[model samples]
Structures are given as C-alpha cells and as structure tokens.
Target: AQTVTQSQPEMSVQEAETVTLSCTYDTSENNYYLFWYKQPPSRQMILVIRQEAYKQQNATENRFSVNFQKAAKSFSLKISDSQLGDTAMYFCAFRRGGGSNYKLTFGKGTLLTVNP
Candidate 1:
C-alpha cells in the first residue's frame, strides 16, 4: 500500500522559468522508492530527488529532475533555473522495498511559489 499523488494544489515559477510538478502513484510492490520533498518557509524537510524501482535512468539533481513512469505510475518533478530559493512546499514521496520503518508516504502538497 504505497500511494503518492500530487495534483498541484499550488505552484508558481518566474525567477528564471521551468517548472513541472505532477505525480501519481499506487503501488502493489515491485521494489519501491520515490521521493521529492522540499518544505521551506522554515518547515525544513529537503531531499528533492530519488527514484529507484529498478532504475530506468530518471533521477537527477542539479536543478532537480525526474520523470520515472514505470508503467503509468507516473512520477514527475522538474524545476530548472527557477530560483528565489525555490520557494517550497513540494512533497511527493513514498517508501517501500525493505524494512526499518521506512515511513514516508506523502503527497498533498505542491505549494511552490518562486517569483522575483
């Protein structure tokens, strides 16, 4: 039971341009792990990129990137050049593939407002 779906509750970008935030997930196990968390405004919880479900090459960080679509389980997050500290509240996470209280199963957020 791994579910993550961020249908953009709020999003804005202008400082530089480029923004794509949309995700969908519902797993029934096949090795799982996908995350993209960034909560600013003093809520601190940052780790904006991670994907490994047998890895099909889709997980980058320098401006953040991911578009892992393992058979329609979509996972998307692409923010490039957009600065302004990347105003945050972007969470689309999931965890399951092992053990050890791998908690994390979120996605009801997408409040990224970066405008300068």
Candidate 2:
C-alpha cells in the first residue's frame, strides 16, 4: 500500500517569487510513479509533473519542477516565478507501475495562494 502526505495544508507566495510544497510517501513497492496535480477553481485535475521511481533525474516542466529523493521517500514541488494563475489546490499522488491496478493514492492537498 502507498500513501502520500503533504505536511503543509496551505502555503502562500508573492507573485513572481518561488514556492516549494513538500510531500512524502510510504510504500513498499520498488516501482512506482509520483505526480503533482493542480486543481484550480474550475476543479480540474491537471498534471503538473511526473517522476518515475527508477529515474535518478528530477522531473521538470517549465516553471514546475520536482525534487525527488527516492531514498528519503520525499518528493517536493517547486514553483518558480509564481503567478496568480498558480493559486490552486496542489495534490501529490502516487501510482504503482506495471500492473492492471492503476489506482492512485493522493495527499490531502495544499492550497497555494499566490498574492500580488
């Protein structure tokens, strides 16, 4: 079984600044995938970034990047040059790799408020 945890329930960042959201997971499975999902007011779950457990390199997508520490079971998201549009509920999720069961375990979420 896998479980994701977001220590911070809420976070704030000034516009054009940067913010890092922390996440930790517990899982016995060696192969899995970690993901950061953004849900805006529209309530759409958007894929911010994804990282494979086997990959040593951190995953990055534009201003959104993830610091993946496999040994520590920690995956944190860094949002650079935060914008008003970045304000949303961010969730950390996990899914097992290579199986018929594609179930995802998600954290409670962290509501990020980007202030101007």
Candidate 3:
C-alpha cells in the first residue's frame, strides 16, 4: 500500500517568486514512481515532473523541479518564477513500478494561489 501526503492544504506565492510545496509518502514497494501533478481551474491533470525510486538524481522540467529524498520518503516540488498560470491544485502521486495495477494514489491536493 502507498499513500501520499501534502501537509499544506493551501499556499500562496507572489508572481516571479519561488515556492516549494511539501509532499511525503509511505510505500512498501521498492520500485515505484513519484510525481507532481497540476490541475488548473479547467480541471486538467498535467504532469509537472516525475522521479523514479531507483534514480539518484531528482527530476526537473523547465521551471518545475522536485527534491526527492528517498530515505526520508519526501518528494517536494519547487516552482521557480511562479506565474499566474501556475495557480492550481497540486497533487502528489505514487505508482508502483511493476504488476498489472497501474493505479495512481494521489494526495488530497494543495491549492496554490499565485498572487500578483
């Protein structure tokens, strides 16, 4: 079983500023994937970034990056130069690497408000 947790239910950041959203997970599986998904007001799940459990390096995509600490079971997202378009519900997710079950367990989500 795997569970993701976002301690901050809501967070606000100023435009062009940087913000880090915290996420933690508990999983028994050794091989897995961790991801940060953004769902805007339009309700589309966009893959922000992903980190494989076996990879030592963190995953980054453009202005979005993740700090993956496997030992601590922590995977936090850092948004550099936050924009108004970045305002959305951010969800932390987990998926086991193998097996037929492709289920993605997601967190409740954190509402990020990018203020001008």
Candidate 4:
C-alpha cells in the first residue's frame, strides 16, 4: 500500500512569485509515476506535471516543475511566475503502471491562494 502526504494544508503566494508545495509518498515499487494535479473552484482536475520514477532528470512543464527525489520518495511541485488562476487545490498523486497496479493514490491536497 502507498500513501501520499502534504505537510502544508494551505499556502499563499503573490502573483509572479514562486511557491513550492511539499509532498512525500511511501511505496516499495521501483517503477512508478508521480503527478501534480490542480483543481480550481470549478472542481476539475488538471494535470500540472508528471515525473517518471526511472527518469533521473526532473519533469518540468513551462512554469511548473517538480523536484523528484526518488530515494527520498519526495516529489514537490514548484510553481514559477504564479498567477491568480493557479489558485486551487493541488493534489499529489502516484500510480504504477503494468499489470493491475494502475490506480491513483492521491494526497489530501494543499489549498494554494495566489494574491495580487
């Protein structure tokens, strides 16, 4: 069984600044995938960025990047040049593909507020 943890329940950041959200997961599987998902007030989950466990280089998508420490099992999300639209509940999820282990285990989530 795997579990995800987000130490920060809430975070506030100013527009154009950067904010890092903490996340650590527990799993014995060597091959897996980490994901950061954002859900705005509309309640739709959007994929922010994803990282493959085997990849040495961290995954980045435009302004969103992840610090993936495979040994520590920590995958944190860093939002650069933050915008008000980035305000939402961010969830850290994990899923190991192949076979029947294809279910997503998500963290409790961190509520991000971007202030102007």
Candidate 5:
C-alpha cells in the first residue's frame, strides 16, 4: 500500500512570496503517479499538478511546480508568486500506474494561509 506524508501541518506565506510544501510516499511499484491538489474554503479539490513516475522531468503549471524524486519517492510542491487565492489546504496524492480504479490516496493535508 502507498502512503503519503506531509510533515508540516500548517504554513503561512506572505502574498507574492514563494512556499514549498513537502510530501513523501512509500510504494514498491516503480510505475505510479503523484498529484498535488488544492482545496480552498469552498472545499473543491482542484488538481494543481501531476508527475508521472517514469518522467524524469518535473511538471509545472503556471506558478506551480513539482520536485519529483523517483528514488526517494518524494514529491514536493512549490508555489511561486503566491496569491491570496492560493491560501488553501494542499494535499499530496498518489494513484497506481494502470488500474481500473485509479482512486487517489491523499495526505493528511497542509493548511496554507496567505497573508496580504
């Protein structure tokens, strides 16, 4: 079974400042996928970014990027030019490479507060 861990329970970043959320996973499968999801107070789980295990290159989306270490099984999310809207509960998730039920297993979550 794969388990995701977020060491930090809470984090705060000034508006426009950069923030990095840590995540580590335990899995034996070489082929898998990692994801970073953000849930605002509205409670909608939005996909921030995804990294394929086989890909050496990290994934980026506008202001978001991931540092994927396959050997370490670590996938951390970096939020650059953070904004007030980026203040949300960030969760790291994982899914099997090829399965009929690609259900995501999420971390406990990291509450990020952006102070303006």
Candidate 6:
C-alpha cells in the first residue's frame, strides 16, 4: 500500500513570495505518477503539477514546480510569486501507472494561507 505523508498540516506565505510544501510517500511500485492538487474555498480539486516516475526532469507549470526525489520517495511543491488566489488546501496524490487500478491515493493535505 502507498501512503502519502504531509509533514506540515498548515502553511502560510506572504503574497508575492515563494513557499514549498513538503510531501513524502511510501510505495513499492516501480512505475507511478505523483501529483499536486489544490482545493480552494470552492473545494474543487485542481491539478497544479504532475511528475511521472520514469521522468528524471521535474514537472513545472507556470508558478508551480515540483521537487521529486524518486529514490527517497519525496515530492514537494514550490509556489513562486504566490498570490492571494493561491491560498488553498494542497494535496499530494499518487497513482500507479501500469497493471494498476488507477486509484489516486491522496495525502491529508496542507492548508495554505496567503497573507495580504
């Protein structure tokens, strides 16, 4: 079974700054996908970034980027030039890529508070 661990339950960042959210997972599966999803006040899960285990290059999308350490099973998300709109509950998720049910396992989440 794969489990996602979010060490920081809550985090805050000043507007227009950078913040990195930490995440670690335990899994024996060789091929898989890691993702960072954001849930705002609307409670809608939005994909921020994704990383394929087979890809060495980290995934990045605009202001969002990931630091994926495959050997250590650590995946962290960095938000650059954060904005008030970025305040949300961020979740880390995993899904097996091959011969799997394709069920997404999610972490508890980290609540992000972007200060004005």
Tens digit per residue, CA lDDT, model 1, 3-52: 78898899898998999999899988888889899999999898988999
lDDT of 6 by residue, 6-110 (tens): 999999999999999999999999999999999999989999999999999999999999999999999999999999999999999999998839999999999
Residue-level lDDT for 39 in candidate 4: 96
Against the true structure, candidate 3 reaches a TM-score of 0.98
| Candidate 5 wrong stretches, greater than 4 Å | none
State the C-alpha lDDT per candidate: 0.90, 0.97, 0.96, 0.95, 0.94, 0.96
The candidate with the higher lDDT, 2 or 6, is 2
**In angstroms, how far off is 79's CA in candidate 2?**
0.3
The all-Cα superposition gives candidate 6 an RMSD in Å to the true structure of 0.6
Which stretch of 10 consecutive residues in model 4 shows the poorest summed lDDT? 94-103
Q: Write the per-residue lDDT of candidate 2 for residues 19-65, one digit (tens) a residue.
A: 99999999999999999999999999999999999999999999999
lDDT of 5 by residue, 3-114 (tens): 9999999999999999999999999878899999999999999999999999999999999999998888899999999999999999999999986888898899999999
Q: Which candidate is the best by lDDT?
A: 2
Positional deviation of 49 in candidate 6, in angstroms?
0.6
Clashes of each: 0, 0, 0, 0, 0, 0
List the RMSD of every prediction in angstroms.
10.7, 0.6, 0.5, 0.7, 0.7, 0.6
Instruction: Identify the runs in model 1 with alpha carbons over 4 angstroms from their true place.
Output: 1-14, 17-32, 42-50, 59-64, 67-78, 81-85, 89-94, 104-115
TM-score of 2: 0.98
| Model 4, position 42: C-alpha lDDT score | 98
lDDT of 4 by residue, 15-62 (tens): 999999999999988889999999999999999999999999999999
Model 2 Cα displacement at 34 (Å)? 0.3
